[model samples]
Target: MPVNLPEIESMELYPVAGVKLGWAQGHIKKANRKDVLVIELCEGASVAGVFTLNRFCAAPVTLCRQHLAGNKGIRALVVNTGCANAGTGEQGMLDAKKTCNAVAELLAIPQDAVLPFSTGVILENLPMDRLLAALPNAVNNLAEDNWKDAAYSIMTTDVAPKAVSEQLNIAGKQVVVTGISKGAGMIHPNMATMLGYLATDAGIEQSLLTEITKEIADLSFNCISVDGDTSTNDSFIIIASGQSEVQFNSREQAGFAELYQSLLASAQKLAQAIVRDGEGATKFMSVNVHGAKTMAEAKAVGFAIGKSPLVKTAFFASDPNLGRILAAIGYAARECDSLNDLDTNLIDLYLGDVLVADKGGLAKSYKEADGQNIMNRAEIDMTVKLNRGDVDVTIWTCDFSYEYVRINADYRS
Candidate 1:
C-alpha cells in the first residue's frame, strides 16, 4: 500500500500528436505482467533527457548517452522492467544494443535513432530472448492514445501508474503536455531516482530543449527521494513533436514560457507521485528549507532531513521527535560549504501549522499533544527557516515503517 496516495481510476491522458505508445507482457521479471513498453515518435520529433550521475550506470544508460550525443534525431524509446542490464560488463551493452536494433528493425529506422531503458534487479543480464520475442508485438500494438497502458507497462514496484496530463492554449494554439513516471524503491536522485517520460505537441529548438531539460529536471525530478539509494538505471526524458500549430524553436518565442511552465507542473506532479507511492511508505513528508544563502544549501538541508532514517522512522511511528530533526539540520550545516556560517539561533522549525521550535529551541507555548496531533496525520509538512538569505526548496520523501524492511528483504524473491 502507498502512503496517502490516491489510486488513480480510469482517467483521461491526452496523447501527443506525434507520439505513439505500445506495450507487451515480456515477463522480464514475472509471468503475465506488462513489463515492456515502446514509445515511437514521428520523424522530426526533438528529444532530450538527463540520466543518472552514478559512475556505474546501467548498460542501456551508457548506450542512451552515446546515441543522444550523436545528435541524430531519436525516433523511439524501448523500456523493460526487471533484470536491470547493469554490472554484466560487455554482454550488457550487447544486450542493450540488441534491444534497440530490435525496435529499429521493426520500425524501419536506424539503430542509432533508438534509446533504451531498463529497471529492476541490478547486476543481472537482460533476458534478451523474451525481450526480442516481445518487440514485434509491441511495435505492432503502437497507438497514439495508449498512455495509460504505457504507464502500467514500465512499472516495477509502483502500486499504481503515475501520469499527468494538461491542455493549455499557447499563442492561440492548443498544446498538450502529458507524462508518466515509475519508481517505488531504490530511490534518490543524482539525476533522478527512477524512469520518467514527458512529451508535448509543442516543438522547441533542439539546442534550447537540451538546455531546459536540465532545468526542468532540477525543479522536479531532482527534488525527491524515497529510500536514499540512487538507482543505476535512473532516467528522465522529454520529447517535443512538431505536429501542432504551436511549434517554436527558441525560448524567445511567443508561447514558449507558457508551454514550458505547463511541462514543469506536469513533471512535478509525476515526481511527487513517486514519493507518495514510495515502497512501504506510511506518511508523505514534505521538507521545506527556506531562507538559505543558495539553492545548493537549501537542497542539502532538505535531503539531510528527508533521508534521515531516524527522522523517517519517527514520523512513521507518529512521533514528533524534534531532536532528530534539529540534529539533522546541524549536520547539514556542517557538511554544506555555503552554510558554513549557518546560525542555529536564527532557525525556526514548524510541523504543519504549529510552531514547534522557535529561534533554535522549543517554542514556549508548544505542547506534546499539539505536536502529536500533527504527526498523526498521513501527510506532514516540516518547514525550516534557516534565516541565512532568501532562497527556498522543497524535498519530497516518505516515512519508513516495518513494511519498508519487509518489502526490500524479500524484493528478490
Candidate 2:
C-alpha cells in the first residue's frame, strides 16, 4: 500500500462540456480488465502535448506528434494498457496507426485527427486484433462523465486511479477542467513514467494551447520522480473544447489567469498522486531547493536528492542519514557544472523543521532523533537552501523499499 495516499473513495470527476470518454475490457494483457480508453473531443477543440525526451519513445508517441503537426484538429484519442508498443520498430508504428484508423473509422472522423497512446511491457507488439475489435464498444459507451473509468483504463502498475476536476466561472460562464494520469515504476523527470490527459471547456487559440501545455507540463509532470528511469511512453496532453461561451484573446484576459491556475493545480495534484502511489512507496517525499542561481540548477539539486537510491532507502529505513543528502547536492552541483561557483559554506539543509545541516555541515544543535522522528512519518519535506540566488524548485518523490525490488523483478513473470 502507498503511504499517505488516500483511496479516491468517490468518483467526483466533473464533465468537461465538449469531451466524452469510454473504456473497454480489451484484455490486452489481463483478462476481464478495462485496458482500453477512448476520448472523443467535440469539433473545434484545440489540443497540445509534450512527450518523453527518451529517444526510444513508443510508436504511439510518434504517431501522436505527427498527427498533431498535421493540424487536423484532433477529435479522438485511443489508449491501451498491457503492451506499450515500444521498441517494436516499424511494426509498432503500423500497429499504432491501425488503432487510430479503427477509432477514426468508428467515429467517422479523419484518420489524422486521432491520437493513440499505449503503456505496458516494452519490445512487444500490441494485440492489434483485439484492440481494434474493442473500438466500437468504447465508442458506443462514450459519455461526458466517464472520466473515472478512463482513469482506470490507463493504468499499468498504478496502485490507484489518479483523477482531478476543477471548475471556475469565466465571464459568467462556468468552465470545467478534468484530468487523469497513471504511473508507478520506470518514473523520473524529463517527463516521468506517465500518460496524462487534461481537458477544459475554456476556449484558447491552438498556438497558445501548445505553448501553455508545455509550460504546465514543466510545472507538473516534469517535477516528479519515482525510480529515476524516464519511460519511453511518457506523455502529457491538454485540450480545450471551447464548449463554454468564454474565450481568451491573451493571457491578460480576466478569466485566463484563474483558469490557468486551476489547470496547473489539477495537473500538479495528479502528478503528486503518481509519486504518492509509487511502486512499493511507503513515504511521499518532497525535496525543495531554494535560493539557487537558476531554476535549472535548483531542479538538478532536487532531482539529485530525489533520485538517489541511497537517500531513498535511508528515508525508507527511517534513518537520519543527512550525509547522503549532502553528497547528492554536491554531486548535482558538479554534474551541472555549478560547483565551482557554489559556496558550500553558505548552504543550509533541513529535514522537515529540524535543521540537520547548516553552512554545509552538521548543525551544532541538530539531533539524530529529531531527523528520525520526521523520517518515520508517512510524509517528509526536505528543504535545501543554496544561498546562491533567488530561484527555487520542488520535486516530488517516494522512499524505496524491498517490495519495489520484488515488484520489478517479478514484473515479467
Candidate 3:
C-alpha cells in the first residue's frame, strides 16, 4: 500500500510573507467534513496558472483566464470540492463570480484577486450559502504551515493526498518550492481532472513565473494519463510571494536559467505523485516512446500507448501482453517504416527482469506465477524502443480495474 516514489518533503519551514491557509467543512454532496479551502495571498504577488484544454472547461477557468489576461494579479484563492461549478451554463458562471466576490469581501481584497476552483459532480449549482458560512472558520484556522492539511482537504475520490516540496540554494539564498495536488480519475491530461497549487518563497519576476509555469506544465501535467477522459475542471496555479528576496533580472542570464530549471523539477515531482495515486491503480506505470520524426509524433505515440485500454487492462492482468503494446503503437503512430522490421527476437519485455515478452510476440516464457508476482508490485514501468529515429517522450499512467469503473460510474451518487 505504500508509494514507491521518493519521499517528498514539505516546504513549511520557509517564511511565506503573504499567504494564509484555510479550509471550511460542508457544502459537499455528502457534507459533514471540510470541503472548501481558501488561500489568501498578499497584495502585489505574481500568479501564473495552467488549465484543462477541454472545450467544455468549467466556468471558473474562463473567469480565471479572463482575469489573468487582464494582468490583474491575484491575492486570494477559493477552492471547493463536491460540486464542480461546470456545465450549469450561465448560472454556474454567476455563482462562481459570486463565490469569488464573497471571498474577496471576507478577505477585504479585490474580486479579481480571488481565483476560484472547484471539483466533484458537474452540472450542480454550487451551494453558495453553505460555503460562505464556513469561510470564517476556515480563515480562523489559517496558518503559515499547513501544506499537508491543505492538500488533504481537496480530495474527492482520491485514496491519499499528494504534496511535495524542495529547497534549492541559489545565489546563497535558499528558494523553497511547495506544491499540493488532487486527482484520482477522469484523468488523461490535456492536463487532467485535478487542481495543483504551487507556492514559492523566492523572488522571481512575473514574466519569468509565466514562462516557467508554462514550460513545467508541458513536461508534467501534460504527460500523464489515467482513464483517457479529460475533465471540464483542471487547474494549476503558482504564487510567488517574493519572501526570499532573491531577485533575478533578465540580465542575470546564467543564474536565472539555473534557478528556473530547478523550479521546474520541483513542480514535476508533485505532478507525478497524482498519477501514482490514480484510482484503482495497483501499479504506477511509465511509458517511453522513442525514435520519432518529431516531438508531436513522439507524444502521440506516448499518449496512444498510455491511454490504450488494451495496454492498461493487460497491465492490470500482468500478462505482459506485448502485442497490445505494439497494437497501440501501430494505431497511434503517424509513420512507421515497417512493423515487421522491428527486432522481435531481441525485444525484452520485462516485469522486473522476468522477461514476460520477447521480440515481437508474447514470450513462450510467459508464466502465470511469474506474471502474478510482477502484478503484485505497487509500481510498474512499460518501455518500448521504436529503434526508428531519435525523438523520445515519457508519460505516466495507472492500471485500469473494475474499481476505477465503479468510482467514476457512481461518482455523483
Q: What is every candidate's alpha-carbon RMSD to the true fold?
A: 1.1, 1.0, 3.3
lDDT tens readout by residue for model 1, 43-152: 99999999999888999999999999999899999999988898889999999999999999999999999999999998889989999999988998999899989999
TM-score (C-alpha) between model 2 and the true structure? 0.98
Better of 2 and 3 by TM-score: 2
* TM-scores, all models, native as reference: 0.98, 0.98, 0.89
Q: State the lDDT of candidate 3 residue by residue for 1-413, as single tens digits.
A: 32454443444434356677887786567757668888988767789998999889899989888878778778888888998889989999998899888888888888987788999888888887887787787787787686777877888887777777667777777777777888888887768788988887766678878877888788888888888899999998888888776776463654676667766776676667777778887778877665655666667767878888888888877766556766776676343334334444544455565656566567797786876676667676666665556777778887787778887788877
Instruction: Write model 2 residue lDDT over 1-413, tens digit each, in one string.
Output: 86666565334788999899999999999999999999999999999999999999999999999999999799999999999999999999999989988898899999999999999999999988899888889999999988888989999888888888887877788899899999999999779989999999988899988988998999999999999999999999999999888887688888888988988999999999999989999999999999998888998899999999999999999988889999998889655776557888999999999998989889999999898899899999999999989999899999999999998998878
Give candidate 2's error at residue 244 in angstroms. Answer: 0.8
lDDT agreement with native, every candidate? 0.90, 0.91, 0.76
Question: Candidate 3 at residue 109, lDDT?
Answer: 80
Instruction: Candidate 2: give the clashing pairs.
Output: none
Residue 35 C-alpha lDDT in model 2: 94
| True-vs-predicted CA distance for residue 148, candidate 2, Å | 0.9
Those runs of model 3 whose alpha carbons end farther than 4 Å from true positions after fitting are 1-15, 251-254, 334-376
Q: Give the range of the ten consecutive residues with the poorest summed lDDT in model 2.
A: 2-11
